[model samples]
Every structure is written in C-alpha cells, then in structure tokens.
Target: MPDTRYTFLDTPIGALLLAGADERLRCIGFPTGKGAVTPRADWHRDDAAFAEARRQLSAYFEGRLTRFDLDLDPRGTPFQRAVWEELTCIPPGETISYGALARRIGRPSASRAVGAANGANPLPIVVPCHRVIGAAGSLTGFAGGLDTKKWLLALERGATSRVSEQLSLL
Candidate 1:
C-alpha cells in the first residue's frame, strides 16, 4: 500500500485523526479506544493533506454544514463497504436501528453483522456511524463511545433546527 498522510485536529468531541492517500480521505479515527487508529511508522504527518477535511469538520461542528462533499476511500470488505455506503445515506439528526440498516442492505438477518461492520467503520463521523441506534431508540455502541455519539446526534439536531429556522425566515 502507498504511504498515507495523516494529521490530528481538535474538536468538541476531542482530537480526531485524519488519514488519506492521493487526495482521497481514507480514515477518520478517534483519539483513543477500540476504534482508534494508532499512528503508523509509515504514515506521514501532513496538515495540508487534511486541510479540507478539517474545514468541513469544523463547519459540521459549528452546524453550518450538513453534507460532506469529499473524496472517500475507506478500505473494507464488500459487505462492510455496502454497510458504510448505506450509512452515508442516513441523513443527519436521524437515527436507524442496526436491524433497519441490515434490512436496507437486503440482509434482514444480518443486524448483528451490520453492527459489526458499523463498529469497524474506518471513517466514523463522515460515514456517520454514530447515527445508528438500538431498535427501541436507545443509543447503542459506538467506536467513539456512547457519549460522543450523543454529542454528535445533538449537534446534528441543533444544526437541523438552525437550518429550518433559517429557511423559515426566507
């Protein structure tokens, strides 16, 4: 594999690690936890490579941007990739159960599998894996922890309301 450029950015949640290659974002890792992506010896620290990601992420945190328009190249199995793709389709401020995600991918019996894929997602916020919840509307497991998930959901909800309010004014 080619060398991946990476950098760290501080956010409301904490520090986030951004990695990419050839101008396409490859991963958005948490600072520490099961989902954390540790620094690799081959990885190069390049803030310029992650400038756009940092900008968009900042906008997202500030509730000024909802959709991310960037090149993504997360490496995973075909099934995992499919799960991640569907995850991106989940609008901000909305939540979907693992079973619902499984059904959406045409594998109704693979809720557990879908959960696993969601857990293993290399790109978290951009992929929006935090939007997944339990069937009963409970906040489920997240790579960045449930607290972080709740914050993300709250951020999106607040952003949605702000956008709606702005639209109402116009």
Candidate 2:
C-alpha cells in the first residue's frame, strides 16, 4: 500500500514501533526480544501519524486506560481474526486458556490453532492476546517476552505502581 507511516513510542517495556497506512494501525511491534519489528525501507517515519495510538498506549502503560479506542487494522486469516476479536472481549485482569479461547470462537477443537493465532497476533497489548494462557493457567510464551506479559497482567490486576517499578528498570 502507498503512504505507509511509522513511528516509535517509548514505553515501560521498550520502544514500540507503530506502523500502518492511511490512519489505520496495522501493527504494534516490540523493541526487544522475540517479536522485534524494524521499519521497512519504503515506510516513512511520522510521529504525528500515530499520535492517538501513542497517547492511548501511554495511558495503558500508566494503567490509566483499560480498553483501547483506536482504529485497528490487524492483518490475519479469517480464523485468526475471529480469535483476535474474541480476545478483545476478555476482561482485564483475567486469564483464559487457549482451549477456552478456541471455544469462545466456536472452534473448541482448535486449541492448538488458537494458540498459533494468538502467537501471530500483530497487536499485542491492544489486542489482548497475552490474556491467553496454558490449560493449567500457567503463563505462556509472549511475543514481547515473558516479563512484559507478566507486567501487563499485573498492571491489569491493580499493580499499576508495581508494574511501573518493575518495567522502569528495563
């Protein structure tokens, strides 16, 4: 697509690369660890393009905002999109297993597929994929790393300052 814009926003976790085209947020990339995303050669850097997202993300990191209100345009398959949509419905401070997530999407037999979709989520925090955990309620792998996931869950559970303190050292 033409006119794809990007900008980096500093957060407690790290610098998140926000990128998309035509005012729609397509991807939110972590700065370090497993899911780091670099800018494309053809993409243009424009902070103003993602100002709203930057503001919302800042509020989220500070525990001032729970649900995001931005125009999201995450790209994925039809099933993945369904899984991601259900992910948004999961309340904050709560965890759901991959099997339960699959059940929520009416594909109860696709727990593994659900996990794969969760792993492929382009927007991590905003999309709430981190809320999905193992069957026994153990923390699972995260695109932004396990520590970031722990902080995110903790922030949702009213440990705002604790999360801030822990992540600020990063």
Candidate 3:
C-alpha cells in the first residue's frame, strides 16, 4: 500500500480521523465505535495533506458549502461501493430510507444488505450515509450514533433553510 497521511479534525460531533494517499481521500473515521479507523503504523500525520478536506468540511458545518469536491478512494466491496456512490447523490437536507436506497441500486430486496453496507461506510459525512433513515422516517442506526445523526440532519436542514431564505431575497 502507498504511504497514507492522516489528520484529526475537531467537529461539532467529535474529532474525526481523515486518511488519504496520493491526494485521494480514503477514509473519514469517527472518534470511536464501529466507525473508527485506527491509524496504521505506515500512516503519517500531515495536516497539509488534508487541508482541502478540512476546509470543505468546515464550510459544510458553517452552512457555506453544500457539496464536496474532493478526490475520494474509499475501500470496500463492490456492493458497498455502489451504496456509497448512491449516497453521494442524496442532496443535503434530504433523506431516503434503506429500502429506497436498496431499490435505487437495483436490489429491491437488499435493504438489509444496504443497511449493512451503509454501516460499514469508510467515509461518513462526505459520503452522506447519515442521510439514510428508517422507512418511517425514524433516525436509524448510525456509526456515529443516533444523536450525531440527528445533529447532522438538523444542520443540513438549517443550512438548506438558510440558503432558501437567501435565494428568496434575490
């Protein structure tokens, strides 16, 4: 494997671990739980390597950025990659159920599998897996915990409302 650089970023939820190589972001781990990815021995700390990601994330939190434009190279199974790719298409402040996501990927009966893949997503906020919810619109399982998921959804909603208000003035 190539040399990967990592950095810890403090966010409203908690500190996040960002890892990447060759300018392609590979992972964004939470501080703990299933979402956490331990830094490898070969990994080196380099804030500069993740400056763009950090900047974009900050903008997102501040409601100044709606979409992320960065090179991503998350590692996962083909099905998981498909799920993650579909996740990126979910607009900010919008959400879909696991069943919906499964159908979107041409697997109408793979809702469980899709949820599993979502739980194992290597990148969370960037991939937007948190946007997936239960069929009844309940906040479901999130690698970063349900509270964090609620916070993210609320943040996006607030940002969307703010953007709408700004646009209405024009």
Best by lDDT: 2
State the lDDT of candidate 1 residue by residue for 51-159, as single tens digits. Answer: 7889999999888998998888999999999999999999999999999999999999999999999988999999999999999999999989776787788788884
lDDT of 2 by residue, 1-170 (tens): 55889999998778999999887899999998878999999899998887888999999888899999999899999999999999999999899999999998899999999999999999999999989999998998899988888988998998858766866688
* TM-score, candidate number 1: 0.90
lDDT of each structure? Answer: 0.88, 0.91, 0.88
TM-score against truth, every candidate: 0.90, 0.94, 0.89
lDDT of 1 at 18: 92
- State the lDDT of candidate 3 residue by residue for 68-162, as single tens digits: 99999988999999999999999998999999999999999999999999998988999999999999999999988776787788788884354
How many Å off is the CA of 65 in candidate 1?
A: 0.8
Looking at candidate 2, what is the lDDT of residue 67?
97
The segments of candidate 3 whose C-alpha lies over 4 angstroms from its true place after superposition are 159-170
98: Cα error in model 2, Å:
0.1
Whole-model lDDT for model 3 versus the true structure?
0.88
Q: What is the lDDT of residue 165 in candidate 2?
A: 81
lDDT of 3 at 94: 94
Better of 1 and 2 by TM-score: 2
Cα displacement (angstroms), candidate 2, residue 128, comes to 0.5
